[model samples]
Target chain A: EAGVAQSPRYKIIEKRQSVAFWCNPISGHATLYWYQQILGQGPKLLIQFQNNGVVDDSQLPKDRFSAERLKGVDSTLKIQPAKLEDSAVYLCASSPTGRGALAKNIQYFGAGTRLSVL
Target chain B: SQQGEEDPQALSIQEGENATMNCSYKTSINNLQWYRQNSGRGLVHLILIRSNEREKHSGRLRVTLDTSKKSSSLLITASRAADTASYFCATDAARGSNYKLTFGKGTLLTVNP
Candidate 1:
């Protein structure tokens, strides 16, 4: 029963540089998500995947941001030409099911990668 | 776009007192959930109340949902210093597009021992 795992707890990059973050979700979890949480603000959903298929990514910045869950167990989110506005915490979360039908079905989050673009 | 907004952006209270946080959403929802996050940490799920349910309790935590008003409240009884954290309310709208959760700005609560 391990929790969701993420790599590079903190990252610092310069504007216009590229950065990538990785996430390994809980075992047997079928859904994974990537969210951006700016300082003093709530998390904004960037993308979602259900069993290697994208469920939603309407809010993602297609020009600069992209994510993929190739094998359905792990995911990676990338941002190219990072801007100052992209300096926020990137959180990775996983859910047991895609429907969220269970009464206690909650999205378990990883420690998150804090990106500081200078 | 953010779906939920929490009130009283920040609060400070002494230990053994009660702490209440409110959240309001703009659209209909299938369920609402509350989560707590310590500084520089990931969020931890606290409670979830479905649309058909009015109230739910877990130990010292009590949650009340009013669909007519599109609002929800979280009450922590006999709060302690350990309860100091940012509390966020997330909504899963009824539209059923994989049931994504939309979060709010959150309420920062500080408890003094």
Candidate 2:
């Protein structure tokens, strides 16, 4: 089985610029997630989607970050007017289950897009 | 906003030895999972232990969860150089009908061949 796929393995942008990352989850997976991993820190959940609807995005910075999963199969996370603090690896992940209780589900992750904002 | 906190931020050991990593969480969880991230790569799911499960084993990996203490530990037996990577523990917390996972900073493990 193929793993979660993300585009543009690495990216570099200037402060105040805009950047976007794409993610294509595993086949038949119903849940998709986007996370940010700053250097030396764990990946922080940015947003989560179940099917074509958002499940949670409380941690996402509404002023600068946004994400969408239009068709429920693929997702895109965007950050506008990026800041130096936004320099981190953006990881995309997926799981097999949908809503309701989370049991023993494990998430599969992509190689991630490393963004370097100068 | 991080739930899990891993111990011994960094560790170095020789091959064939045992490597143990511990994680503690702040709130209640439905399950705990471990993931491995190689340099410049995304995370890979290593194992998952439900709150009801005290221990689980897969291959050379063993995970123990103590809900009373809100702590968990991962043991890699006969570690290999290939095991060198950053290990993170994630807690699956339920919010109403939805769920979210909070990951820790991670433990950087170095194994010498």
Candidate 3:
């Protein structure tokens, strides 16, 4: 099967500009997630979706960041008025579900979109 | 907040040698996982060890988890140049609505041939 797919392997944008990244998860996967990985740091979860419903988004910057998984297969994460701090790699991952030992929390990641804020 | 923190931000090893990386977490966790990422690439799941288990092995990879100390270690035996990559430890904490993995800063390993 194909792996999770992310668009625009790299992106360069000016501060205060808006940018968006797209993710297409593995087929039949029920859960999707968006994470921000700053240089030299681990990935920070921005939002998670179980199908079309959001499971968690507590770490997301509500004032500037937003994400949606409309059909439960593909998702998009957007940042408006991007700041220098937004310069990081955006990673997308997916799993079959979030329960049981068979498929509880094994996440497969994409190549990620590296964003640069100038 | 991040759940796992890996030690030795960077490590260099020669082929045929064993490479070990450590990770420590703050809170209780259900499971811990290891992933490897090539330069400018996505993360690939290496292994997952549940809280009830102490050790697991997959091919040349061995993982040991100590819940009492809240620490884990990954050992790659007979390392190869292809093993050069960043390894990260992720933990599935008990808190929150669902199982979300909190990753560590990662350990960059360079295996020279």
Candidate 4:
């Protein structure tokens, strides 16, 4: 099985600029996640999608960050007017299912997009 | 809010030695998972221990979970330089679905050959 795939390994933008990242999860996966990782911090869940429907987005920084998963397959995360503080690695992860211990136990991740806001 | 904190934020040791890292969490959890990351890239799942299970081992990795103390530890025996990376402990909050993993800051381990 192929691992989760992400595009544009790196990106650089100015403050207030917009950026987007794409992710392709493993086949048959029904849950997708977007996370933000600061240089010295752990990944923080920005949004979670159970299939095409959103299961959680409580910490998405909705004013600028948004994500969507279509057809319950691929997902995209976008940050509009990104701030200097938004410079971090954006990671995408997927699980086999939203429920069940099998799915909860593991998450496959992508290489992530390293964003630099100048 | 972070669910856990890892001890010895960073460690250095020689190859063939054992490396152990500890984690402490705040809330009740259904399970605890450990993950490894290299160069701050994608994370790789290492192991998982259920709330009822006290210990588990995979390959050279050993994980112990203590629900009573709300803590867990990861031990790597006969580690190699390839084992050098950041280790994170994630907890699945009892209140939410199991996929809601709350990760700690992580412990960076350096294994020198």
Candidate 5:
């Protein structure tokens, strides 16, 4: 099976500029997630989606970041007026829903987009 | 302050040696998972041990969970240069949908050839 896919492996933009990252999860996976990994740290959850509905986004920076999974398949995460602190790797992951606890939480991750803010 | 905290922030060893990394969490969890991330890449799931499980093994990886102590350890035996990477432990809370995984700062292992 194909793994989760993310585009624009690396991106660089000036602060206050806008950038967007795209993700295509594995086929038939109903749950999608976005995470940010700063250098020297583990990935941090940004938002989670159960199909087209959001399950959790508590850690998302609402003011500058937004994400949508309108079709409940492919998703996009955007950051406007990006800041220097936004320089990090953006990872997308997915998993099958409604399965057993063991299977449900087995997330498959994409290679991630490396973002650099100047 | 963080849910998961890994010890020995970094580990370096020669190939063919065993590498052990420890992680400690603060809350009760339904399960704990270990993952490896190569530099400049995403994380790859290694293994998962449920609260009821004390130990699990997959190929060269072994994970042991101690619920009473809220801690876990990952042992990689006969390490290879390819084993060099950052290892992380993630904890799944006992509550909610079990979709969220609280992760630690991670331990960087460098297996020299």
Candidate 6:
């Protein structure tokens, strides 16, 4: 099976501008996730979706970031009025199962979109 | 907030040697997982060891979890140049009906051939 796919392997935008990244998760996967990894740091969960509805997005910055997984397959994350601090690699992942302790949470990740906010 | 914090921010070793990386978490977890991220690439799940599992082995990799101490370790036997990458430990903390993973800063391992 193919892995999670993300678009625009790299992106560059000026501060106060807007940028959007798209992701297409592996087929049959029920859960999708978006994460941000700043340089020298591990990826941080930005948002999570189980099918077409969001499971958790508490860590996301509501004022500037938003994401949606319509139809439960493809998802998009957008950042408006981007700041320099937003410069990081945006990673997309998917799991074969949904939420719960018994659910298998082995996530498969894409190459990620590196955003450079200048 | 980050739950897992890996020890020894960076390590450099020659091939054929054993590499050990340690991680410690703050809260109770259902499981802990290790992932490898190559330069400019996304993370790849290396292994997952449940809280009930004390130790697990997959090929040349061995993982040990100590819930009492809230710590875990990853050992790569006979390391190779291909093993050079950033290794991160993620703790799965189940909240109510939701499950999420909190990751650490990671350990940068460099293997010399």
Cand 3, B chain, TM:
0.97
| lDDT: worst 10-residue window of model 3 chain A | A96-105
Q: Is candidate 3 or candidate 6 better by DockQ?
A: 3
Residue A22, candidate 4: C-alpha displacement in angstroms = 0.4
When candidate 3 is compared with the true two-chain complex, its DockQ is 0.90
User: A32-115 in candidate 5: lDDT tens per residue?
Assistant: 999999999888999999999999999999999999999899999999989999999999999886677688888899999999
Better of 2 and 4 by TM-score: 4
TM-score each candidate.
0.97, 0.96, 0.97, 0.97, 0.98, 0.97
- Residue pairs clashing in model 3 are none
The CA-based lDDT of model 2 is what? 0.92
Of candidate 4 chain B, the 10-residue stretch with the lowest lDDT total is B93-102
Q: List the residue pairs that clash in candidate 2.
A: none
Docking class of 3: high
lDDT of 2 by residue, A34-115 (tens): 9999999999999989999998888999999999999889999999989999999999999886444453167889999999
DockQ value of candidate 2: 0.79
**Residue-by-residue lDDT tens digits, candidate 5, B1-113:** 25899988999999999999999998889899998999988899999999999999999999999999999999999999999999999988998844788789999999999
Tens-place lDDT per residue, model 4, B8-40, is 799999999999999999999988999999995
Candidate 1 has an lDDT of: 0.94
lDDT of each: 0.94, 0.92, 0.93, 0.91, 0.93, 0.93
Give the residue spans of candidate 4 off by over 4 A: A98-100
lDDT, candidate 3, A3-118, per-residue tens: 99999899999999999999999998898999999998889999999999999999999999999999788999999989999999999999885366547588999999999999
Best-matching candidate per TM-score = 5
Lowest lDDT 10-residue stretch of candidate 3 chain B: B92-101
lDDT of 3 at B52: 94
Clashing pairs in 6: none
Q: What TM-score does chain B get in every candidate?
A: 0.98, 0.97, 0.97, 0.97, 0.97, 0.97
* Candidate 1 segments whose C-alpha is farther than 4 A from its true place: A98-100, A103-105
